[model samples]
Target: MTVASKDVGMMTMIENGNEVKRTCCSSNSGCGSSEILVEYAGNEKWIQGVINTPKGVVPVVSTQLNFSDILGSWKARWGVNRMNYKINPGLYAVGTPDNESPVLVTANYKSTFDSLRKELADINTWILVLDTKGINVWCAAGKGTFGTKELLTRISCTKLHEIVTQRTLILPQLGAPGLSAHEASRQTGFQVVYGPVRAKDIKEFIRRDMTATPEMRTVKFTTYDRLVLTPIELVEAIKVSIIAFGILFLLNLIVTIPFGLDDFYAYVGALIIGCVITPVLLPWIPGRAFAWKGWLLGFIWAVVVNLINGWPQLPSYSLVRAIGYLLVLSSISSFYAMNFTGASTYTSSSGVIKEMKIAVPIIIITVSLGMLLILLNSFMGI
Candidate 1:
């Protein structure tokens, strides 16, 4: 069959103990053909051909590579610190696709492909990888890079029409913003079918014949999901934590009597309690705002400190100093907890900004007043 330059051609041939011969010749050749031969083993089901180009001849795979192997190789090459090499975003074939196999569409990002394949073990499907420039589908769709135009262009470039018999292509639900379903069908013969929001749900979605219920479309931020993000947050917060703790410790040492190691530890503990623990346990801490939750946790920490350190029973000046430290620590912790909303998916950007504006001033005022009161109490010998 003669395939168009913009078409990807799929052919099935049967051979009986002899190699099938074929030739490819460009129109530029005076003989009207460049002599090339395709040797198909008698048992071989398919053969791939590549047209030499300026850069190099690119290999065209007739059979799909194992999805797990593809994903594993990608992770090995690009996982942790190898961020320099940009991922290739374009059409890729997954599994051994026959003319009738289901076509699954995905973003070009290696990570996104890995996620989809890793979750879809034992499933025989064709993956039509779209060029999204290394971004996930949700973000790419929002940026319009994964929009209808690219989809149509890719379909033409890959000659997907020649490979699959069906006229349907499965896309991720999050990509709906950038795709015009009606326009896609008009531009390309293929009709668009939006899949589930998450790749993990694809198996079940396919079982249900590509129909996504409301539950499949919804995005949830459960505690476990939130907790998975904590490590990154902790790593990012380390620099700020160090500077804040150093300043607070110095203040504690200078304002109080002979500098003690215990005082330094207490100040450090307050920093962690406020910045880390408070944010994680935010919802259960009895307040709608993160600052209030931090304050509540801080108050509890103070009570525990008073009991353990016997600070309440200390001399008047020392008791006052202890109270000052606890109050300031609590205020700081609560304030930092409020910053967590920015990283949370559940919190809107506007809501986070609003919380920060209101909470920051309260934290500053309370911590400042607590420090000032302690100094005055020390001077008055109260």
Candidate 2:
């Protein structure tokens, strides 16, 4: 278990703590004693330490309270209701582990870490948490906070190699894009093992010796999963939707005093249709692209408005006004729906960009034309 001296890199303390500037045996090598020179603010201090090699010294600061303990504090601070703003991002340890347990890595976002640990009630494992700055695994990985450099740094700082007997680290599959498996192995003696896409499947993955089948690796945005996301989307968009609705409703009142109520209600309904219903029914809607699906849902909303308002029975001028309203509503609804595609696991970056390129112009045209027609009708008193 002796790590060759040549394999050891320079020891540097990254934080505000005292710097230790001496090379010692690799913590993994089971060396019983090593000398550490502590330097801080141009002051030098030396201490001859007898550290148990292979079983690294666990810093008091590195150890974390159980996830359940943290969750209890979270509940007291932010009620029982769940929301994005309530989440705290930091490192967390999942499952109990003595010095020899396998280290499983994850982000510090409470919700994400909770999801990981809650699913592994019976297993005893060591969890190494990375600071993801409050983001989930997928997005954090894309942002580079969850990348290879950070992983290596954290491992070094924690002295993870010495803490565990096995030279293996388990990482989430979603983080693969940010990590270079080969480089990580070369830099740190720990071999990287990617686990399943969801934390719930981790037990099985561990039981199977860190191998994930195709089903476990693939991310699925099932109906239930999509629906769960709807609350956050709706809650976040509510304020904007209300302001937009108010402006549109006021414009409707100014344009047609008699039909103002109908116009206001139609626009409001469209906002809800686009931001709420469309997200909930995203999968069942027609097209592969989220924009198209939104558009289809918008069309249905327009049809509902037309049927309810008796468009055919109205004067030709009124009928034109109604069509104008419907067109604008549909466009706005569809546009917002397209934005929700970002939240989906299925939509790739390329696909979202392609859809936006085509959809933006179409939305602008429809909404602009609809608004112009309403103004024209109002001016001419049609």
Best by lDDT: 2
Candidate 1: misplaced stretches above 4 Å? Answer: 1-86, 107-111, 128-165, 176-190, 245-283, 315-320, 367-382
TM-scores vs. true structure, each candidate: 0.63, 0.75
* Local distance difference test, candidate 2: 0.64
Worst 10 residues of 1 by lDDT: 30-39
Q: Give the TM-score of candidate 2.
A: 0.75
Q: Give the per-residue lDDT digits (tens) of candidate 2, residues 186-209.
A: 887889888899988999998897
Error of 2 at 139 (Å): 0.9
| Cα-based RMSD of candidate 1 | 11.0
